[model samples]
Target: MKKVVFKVGGSILQELPESFYKLLIELKEKKVCDPVIVHGGGPEINQALEQMQIESTFIDGLRVTTEEVLEVAQMVMCGAINKRIVSLFQNQNGKAIGLSGVDGKLLQAKPIKDGKLGFVGEVTKVETAWIDMILQAGGIPVISPIAAGEGETHLNINGDTAAGAVAEALGCRLVLISNIPGVMETIDQKEIIHHHLTKEEVEALIDSGVIYGGMIPKVRSALASLQGGVEESVILNGLEPGDILKYLDGEKVGTILSEKEVVEHV
Candidate 1:
């Protein structure tokens, strides 16, 4: 079965509509795609940290994960958020198994930023055979971004980075779903999302300051996914009804980020 890795942002999870999940079931039933979900829980983590009176910080879109913060992150991501997604799938009549990178050594990693980022990790390796096993059994894998090291060490990975790595490992499509619609730019003095973006075009936008902040990592991950042999990469809003199917059908629904603009198949 063809695979697609979906990276769902924390900000959108709480409001995910049932119809969004119905599309996943449709894809599975129709044999259109096998979907894997990698999720983030930044908002919930922040709230939990605040409630516990623990300080939090981020540098360049990566959470500066101190040991204390990592504890909070693991709880919110692996415990709360992961099961929420799994329950949603079950309620939608889809069989989903929630997992962490630590499970079955699916993802292996080492500390990044010379340990300055504490437990933040760069994905060194991804094992997709087990993921394929789940897919073969007609089960969707709902993954949290928390990873484990050699022993007694858990690493927090960026959701987009994790998703991109999974897509690269599977050599499949990558769909980056967020609350916002897509990558935006000012055209004719009116803000509009670029339907298709090339490397050069995206670079120019970054240089011109049209793309900055959180979007930098997102677009960069898309470029990285394409370079890593992912079939296609797109950034689109998950809340939009039927947008996922429309994008997969190549109907120009969202911002298509690519090394080059390839013709859509359907």
Candidate 2:
């Protein structure tokens, strides 16, 4: 079966309708694509931290994970949010198994920036067989981004990077689901979707400040997924779940990234 990895950000996870979950169930049952989901819990984590009287911050889409914050992140990402998604699937009669990177040693990691970002980690390696097992059993694997660290430690990883690493390891397709349409360009004061982008063009836009905020790591992750052996990487709006069908059906749906220039479609 062909594999497809999805990175669903926390911002949209809560707002997603039942229709989205149904589509996923339909796709999996039909064997359209073996879907592996890597999800983020930024907003949820922040809410939890604030309620617990802990401060949380982010740098370039990656949460600056302090030991205290890491505790909350794990709690929210692995405990609450993960189970919630699983329950949602069960509610819809869909099959899903929620697991953390620490589970089955799925994601191995090392500290990013010499531990300057505290417990923030960069994915050093991804173990795909664990995920493959779940998929082969006909269950979607809902993964949390917290990774296994050296000797009884755990690290918080960027969601997009985690998804990219998984895609690379599995050598599959990756679709980063977000709230927006895709990478946007402000041409003549109008936000225009790039429709398609190359790494060079994405970098140029980033350097020119067209791509900033959370989008920086998102595009970079898409690029990484492409370089990491993914057959295709795209940024798609989860609001329109039907677009996923369009994309899987080989129709243009979102911003498809490329390493080399490709002719743009109207």
Candidate 3:
């Protein structure tokens, strides 16, 4: 069976409908594919930091983790957000195990940029055996992106990056669940979603200014994961009901980013 790693951000966690959880349960019950979720807790962490009077900062979509920030991040991602997701799945009658990269050494890492980001590290390794165990046990693994670094240090990881690593390690597809439908371009006065895009095509679109602003980072991140051995990175709207299922069912519901060339949607 195939496995699909989902990267869900905290910004959309509350907005995800019950139908989404139900769909996940349905997929598991039907043995469609093993669905693994790697989640972020950015907004929640920010809120907690504010309550504790700590400044929140980021560099290129990655949080700058000070010692205090890491503490709060751990509490939020591993404690609150993690359990909440597990509870949601359990509420839907789906068995789920919430975990952090620190749990079972699922993800091992080291400091990046000479610790310029301060406890923010990139995943150097992903232990896929634990994830396989959970999948074999008929349970979904909801992972928080807190990685175990050298010594006793715990590091904060990017949700997308973590999910990409997991997908690459498992040789599975990476589905990035976000608010937007996909990469859109106005053609003939109508907004159209590009169903598929290659790395070069994405760059051309960015140069043409069709892809700009917030989407730039998202698409670039997806493309970067392609270079990291991920077969495809899918960007779709989690807010839209059935978009994920539609894509899974072979309907054109999102933008698929791959290194290879493909027919572009016109």
Candidate 4:
């Protein structure tokens, strides 16, 4: 069976309803594409850091991880948020295992940006044997974005990048599950979502200033996954949980991006 990596952000986690988990369970139980999750914990981390009187600094959208910040992030991502996701699945009678990149050296890495962002790393390797084991055993693996770094050090990884890496390693489709409906464009004075886009189309949109700011990184990351050998990348709305199934059914519910200009729904 094919696999799909669902990348979810921390900000939208609480907004996801139980029906979403139930859909995931149905996907697993029905022998559809194997659904794996890589999640973020930004809001929870911010709350934890604030309670501890710690400040967060960001450079180019990445958190500058000091030693203390790393501890709190690790605690929140691996411990609290991870288990909460697992429990959500279990609550719906689904088998789900929560893991961090540190576990079993799942994601081995080294620091990026010349170490300017302390303890922030990129994935150099992904050991997918255990992930396959979990999938074969009929369980969903929910991963947190924390990489094991050199010589007993742990590094923070951006969740989208982490998901892209996993999709690359597994040679699978990557679904970016976010709050927004999809890439929107004003056509005929009506805001309409572009259900399909190629790299050239995306670039044209970018040039026309249709895709700007915050969304640039998102679309770029999706394109990067295609370059890294992922089959396809989709921008999906987590709020409309049913859209996932719609996309899978080739109903054009969200934006499907491809390297080539050809439009293939499924």
| TM-score on alpha carbons, each prediction | 0.92, 0.90, 0.94, 0.94
Better of 1 and 3 by TM-score: 3
Better of 2 and 4 by lDDT: 4
lDDT per prediction?
Answer: 0.86, 0.87, 0.89, 0.91
Best by lDDT: 4
How high is the lDDT of residue 86 in model 1?
A: 94
Per-residue alpha-carbon lDDT of candidate 1 for residues 71-189, written as tens digits (9 for 90 to 100): 89889999999999999999989999999998988888899988778899978888898899999999999989888786878899988888988999998889998666788878889
Better of 2 and 4 by TM-score: 4
lDDT per residue for candidate 2 within 159-247, as digits (tens), equals 88899889888877789997888888787888788878999999999999989998987888888877777777898888889988988
lDDT of 4 by residue, 35-109 (tens): 999999888999999999998888997779999999999999999999999999999999999999999999988
Taking all chains together, the TM-score of candidate 3 against the true structure is: 0.94
Q: Is candidate 1 or candidate 3 better by lDDT?
A: 3
lDDT, candidate 3, at 123: 95
Clashes (N, CA, C under 3 Å) per candidate: 0, 0, 0, 0
Candidate numbers, best TM-score first, in rank order = 4, 3, 1, 2
